[model samples]
Target chain A: MRLERRASVPPILYVAAPLAAVMVALAISGALIALAGASVPEAYRRMAIGAFGSRLAITETLTRATPLILTGLAAAVAFRARLWNIGAEGQFYIAALATAALGGAASAGGLLPGPLLIPFLMICGAAVGAMLLLAPLALRLRFGVDEVVVTLLLNFVVLLFVSMMIDGPLRDRMAFGWPQSVRVSPEAALPKLWQGTRLHVGLLVAVAMSVVVWIIQSRTAFGLEAKAAGFNPRAAAFAGVPIPKVLVGVACLSGGLAGLAGAIEVMGVKGYVTTDLSPGFGYAGIVVAMLAALNPIGVVAASLFVAATFVGVDGMSRALKVPSFIADVTVALSLLCVLVALTLVTYRIRR
Target chain B: MSETLDILASASLWAAVLRIATPLLFGVLGALLCERSGVLNLGIEGIMTFGAMIAWLTVFKTGDLWFGLAAALACGALFGLLHGGLTVVLGLSQHVAGLGVTLLGSSLSYYLYRLAIPVSGSPPTITPFQPLKIPLLSDIPLLGEALFSQTAPTYLAILLTLAVAYALAKTPLGLAIRLVGENPHAAEAQGLDPIRLRIGVVAFGSALMALGGAFLTTAAFNSFFPTMVQGRGWVCIALVVFASWMPLRALGGALLFAFFDAFQLRLQHVTGKAAPYQLFLMIPYLMSIAALVVFARRAKVPQALMQPYRRGER
Candidate 1:
């Protein structure tokens, strides 16, 4: 009998592979922890406790997860359409700036009520975010420019622009010369979900958005066209689907979601923009999107899991004195492992 | 207006341009080899970090600069091997594999550095490479000071660019590599192993990238820090496009970016609180985007770039 590669493997393998990949990633992280002179089991226990051991811990996890959910969705939506829009980080920065500028000005002016102000700022944030990708999108469609590098380079430009704003125009004179934007008006702030906890309505909004995305992706004709464009662009173009329009639309939606995250972050959490506000949330979003296999509902689960790692690892570092970067290593390893695992699930050995 | 003129007339400003361009030159050349071999090594950012850390750590330990450089080169080759295995052997997606390699390199370097070096107090320092004045050439006026008096790596970068330009145009090995990149099936039909050639080129290119990283620490700053590479690797990716995959053109692109970078740093001192220096910092990045928009239509990218080669597959 000759061995051959089968076209498809059992469906069970798809589910099992990611789970195995997670286990392998955790195991590798355990070794890293040991190298850092921490007891793996003790550190892990601390992490779990930090992530979900108490109501306060759970709230903190959700709080940390709010932006992640949005960014993850951003990557998923764009990547699903093969748009390669890696500038979510820059879009998030742009949105944060827009939110801070508009929210602070409107609130200080008492131009809108609290309920109205928050929604208005968020909408502006999303709009600005979408606008950020217009150049990259145009270049990609018109000139066949590689969106990946263009998007990546744009991240730096937007970040520097924000830094300039914070240092110059947006500086709060009342705050004694800090490199930060003016405080947003209390009216523009996102209301807390729980009065006693840091949890805010932003979490609810993120989850709601995920459901909306899931419906759009699974139930809409546009979603079908997006899937077709991504999997086989030539075929989609031959079939008369507006490939360019679909890509541009998906990029806008992705950028909008990411911008919403930045707005929520500023309005709900930071209340101002700082240079170090995001700890690579945009980059981590790629991992989250890939781990979820670009499924909107699965993005929710992936976001929460990644959020827990961030929260848990902070505690692990404090208790075990290990460097928190081990968490990043784990996430990266999981990405590589999942890719391999998924590839395995795509093929079977036939005799 | 007079201050601007003075800044332009200063010898140091031009020297700074040459200095700033040195590491970027190494990176652009490194990326050139990989892209020319039909691989997009987005891992350049992370691999550079590995080189920087290894070079700093090795030099800090042994007090030997060459040893540090060697260690960095080895680490870069190792990461390139990892990228090659994932993309060439396993037939994984180039974009994902490249990003994965980047994440792995960056995080691993950070973790290892934290473990090896203590966090408290000042970081260990080394006597960084000092500029060597060329005997007769240093006597020349403006150009000599900017070009002749330089660190070893700066000179090496120039030599390497010329050597690479020559190799790509003149050598049979270069032709074989180009053949594999352009049309692997055709290369295979000529009895050349496409996968092996791709892997070899990737490894060689990555080794050059690692050297560039080492130059950042050992020659430029004498100390390594996380994020010091600071998107230069990504800039090199853009430079590849800007140069249209030509080594000589990449040299010009690298210098153009370096000039803006050095000028930005100088402009910051004169224009303090008047203009946002951040805008000046954005010049190189913005120029790159502008360059892409202008030249992307004309740039002849390698035919098989970003595609995985598999035997007997259509």
Candidate 2:
């Protein structure tokens, strides 16, 4: 058998591919549900209901999707340029900590007025995240190092650094020796979109950012240059696209998006930083981006799918005694399946 | 200063270095073998995690440590097959596919563990491998106790290093693999199947990686826990660059890294409250980045590394 590239791909394949991938992933994970001695159909029914059943359930899923949307965009932006920023997890942690630190100090010292504090913390948080990624990117540019390994290794380093800060300088005194940072001031908390629900304005910000990113990617000159560099760096360089500057710009935007996820996550939900602040939100972002085929607008939909899977799986597991890790397995399977589906969209097998 | 010097003089410290180096020894060699054949297995982290879990589970169930190790190797080969099929046969993105494999392996391991074993205060344990003493070597001075008295897997890891180094340098098969990595067209012209060679090598290399994970549970620790593999798999990837894709140098790199790890652990104990323990934990990761900076420029990378091979395409 041989594979032949298609001259033109139908627009419908873009929509059909992810949907088909998710169906296949669910069918495969159904076996795991059966293995856990739960009825597969029943378990799936529970998952769907748990995700969308009540006002509370829908709000919780959206709240979960808020950080995922930002992180998904982070991965989408970086992966588009082929930057492979695996350190999003680390960037999330560091940015969250930075936001918390700024929020606490600003409130305690009366340093900034209430209305301005949130935006200030958000900007500072993103800057810190941007700088974190630039270190690895600089290494790649100067030394010709593969950014994949360097970015991955930095995740562990950043996590440890966060651990040290929460346990030492950032530790909350009144929390009875628990290793967590002091709470962000009320002034720094993001306003809730609906009263009596956990859903905050972060969801609105995430949805708006998705639209903004889509416009930047599809309608801007810089996006065209970035895509050109990604397609063929040698050709782009020969065309005077300035590959280094483009990569640096992509790195900042990608890192800033991830950092903003951390900042918003703290302000909107937890109100404090801990080692377990993110349940692999950074890693999940990669899967979300891939499932969306690295499209900025598609990332919002993909994040919602992932967040629902996770939130729904939690409720399903509680009801059926199935392991919650099935959510991770499902997400991972969809990523691999989507990769294959995307390949099929571009190429056909001939025997 | 004297307290720091005293750590270097202790026999136990040297022994700890070897113990810590054992898993890394397997991991670096596994990664090196795969990369030398033009396939980058970024799935090492998840592969190792699965290996650690499956081996411990096997031992816990059957009460046979060797069987547990065998189970881990078998499961690892299966994961490798999945990874190899994706990258080699399907011609997918190596980066994304490997990450998918990692996610699948780790989460599946956790799911299986939770399914098989009920949640409790602490995870179950098994009788791990005890250190074996080489008769006369164990009687010698500091070097004897540190080097000669180690678990069976530690010795196997060292011997495997020599075997890999020799096979790569002297064997025709190794030459074919290297040729495939450098220029598959040349290998194809010479009547070798680059596709099969890459798939086979990735599978075998991944088995070694699983054994490295097995070592963590069966020797380094007696119990299995989530995330225990930590970032050791990633550190091994860096060591591959540090070694410049040579087996003997890979061995040296693993030892050097483990020495830093062992020393920092000791330093943590010596300093007590003077510094935070997390800072010491950060040393190995920071050191890997520093090593990459130092050697990445000078290293000769495999020409076809990370490039997917199509039967007829250049």
Candidate 3:
């Protein structure tokens, strides 16, 4: 058998490939469910219901999807430029901490009026996130160091740094020694989008940012340059595109989006920062970005799907006695299958 | 300042350093072998997690430690095959596919562990490897107790480091592997199949990596827990660059890292409450990044590293 690259792929294959991959992934997970002595169909039914059956369920999934969408966009933008920003987790933490610190100060000192505090904190958070990522990007550009390893290692370092801070300087004294930051001032908290629900306006912000990123990637001159740079750096350089500038732009956008995710999560959901504020949101963002094929708009859909799976799996695990890790397994398997599916879309196997 | 010197003077501190280095030693060699074959096994973190779980579970159930290690090696190879299938055979992006493998391997480990063992206050434990003291060698004052009093796997790790260094430098098979990595087309010209060689090397290297994880469960600690691998695999990846893809230097790098880690742990105790212990925990990762900045420019990388090899494509 030989694999041959297709001359041209139909546009529909892009959509169809991911759908097929998800189905295949779910089937594989069903087999694992069966192995665990659970009815696969029943488990899936429970999952579906748990994620979308009730208003509360739907809202909960959407609430979880809020940060995921932003983080997914973070991964999407970086991966599009082949930047490989794997330290989204770290950026998310640092951003959240920064946002918390700012929000705390603004709330206590009336540093900013109530209406202006949210935007101010978010801008600062994004700046912090961008700076964190730029450090590694600069190292890579200057020393020929691999950003992948540096970004990954930074995740651990940042986590420990966050741990130290929350346990020391950022420690909320009223929480009986729990290592977490002081709650954001009430005036600084994000207003609820819907009454009597956990869902906040952050979901709206995430959706808006996805649209904004979509435009930047598809319509902007920088987007074209980034695409060229990623596709072939030598060709891009020959075309007189500043490769370094494009990468620096990509770094700031990617890191800023991730930082925004953290900032939103703090104001919208928890109103504070903790080391566990992100439940692998940064890593999941990579999976989401890949599953979306790195299309900014597609990230919104992919994140919702991922969020539903986690929310559904939570309920399913308690009911069926299956481990909740099944959600992670399902997501990870889908990523691998999608990579294959995308390959099949671009190439044909001939025997 | 004197306390720092006193901490280093203790024989147990040196012994702990060797113990900590054992797993990293196995890990770096495994990673080095794979990278030398032109594949980046980013799945090391998850693969190691699976290895830790499977080894401990095997020993816990079967009451045979060697069997547990064997089980881990086999499982690790299987995961390697999965990774090789994606990155080598399909010609997918190594970074993405490897990350997928990591996610799959780690979550699968946790899922299976939960299925086998019910939720409990603490995880179950097994009889870990005891220090196998050499008769005459272990009798020496400081060096003997530090080096010769390690467990069986620790000794194997040291021997394997030398073996890998020799094989990579001298053997015909090693030459073929390096040739494939440096120039697969040249290897193909010489009538060697690059794909098969890569898959084989990746599998063998991944098996060794599982042994590293097995050491963690069956030697360093008696029980398996989620997240216990704790980015050690990433550290090994960094050590590979620090080693400049050389086996002997990989050994030296792992030892140096282990020494820093062991030293920090002691320093944390000595300087209790003066600085947060988390600061000490951050040393190894920070040091890895610093080492990369220093060595990455000078490090000679395999030309075909992360490159997809097609049989006929130029």
Listed in order, the DockQ scores are 0.63, 0.87, 0.90
User: What ranges in model 3 sit over 4 Å off?
Assistant: none
* Cα lDDT over the full model 3: 0.93
How much is A117 displaced in model 3, in angstroms?
Answer: 0.7
lDDT of each: 0.87, 0.92, 0.93
CAPRI-style docking class of model 1 based on DockQ: medium
Model 3 docking grade = high
Give me the TM-scores of chain B across the candidates: 0.97, 0.99, 0.99
**Residue by residue across A179-215, what tens digits does model 3's lDDT show?**
8998889887889988899999999999999999989
lDDT of 1: 0.87
Superposed Cα deviation of residue A160, candidate 2 (Å): 1.1
Per-candidate TM-score against the hidden true structure: 0.97, 0.99, 0.99
Error of 2 at A148 (Å): 1.2
* Alpha carbon lDDT at B27, candidate 2: 90
Off by over 4 Å in 1: A1-5, A348-351, B1-5
Candidate 2 has what TM-score? 0.99
Q: Point out the higher-scoring one by lDDT: 1 or 3.
A: 3
Kindly give the number of clashing pairs for every candidate: 0, 0, 0
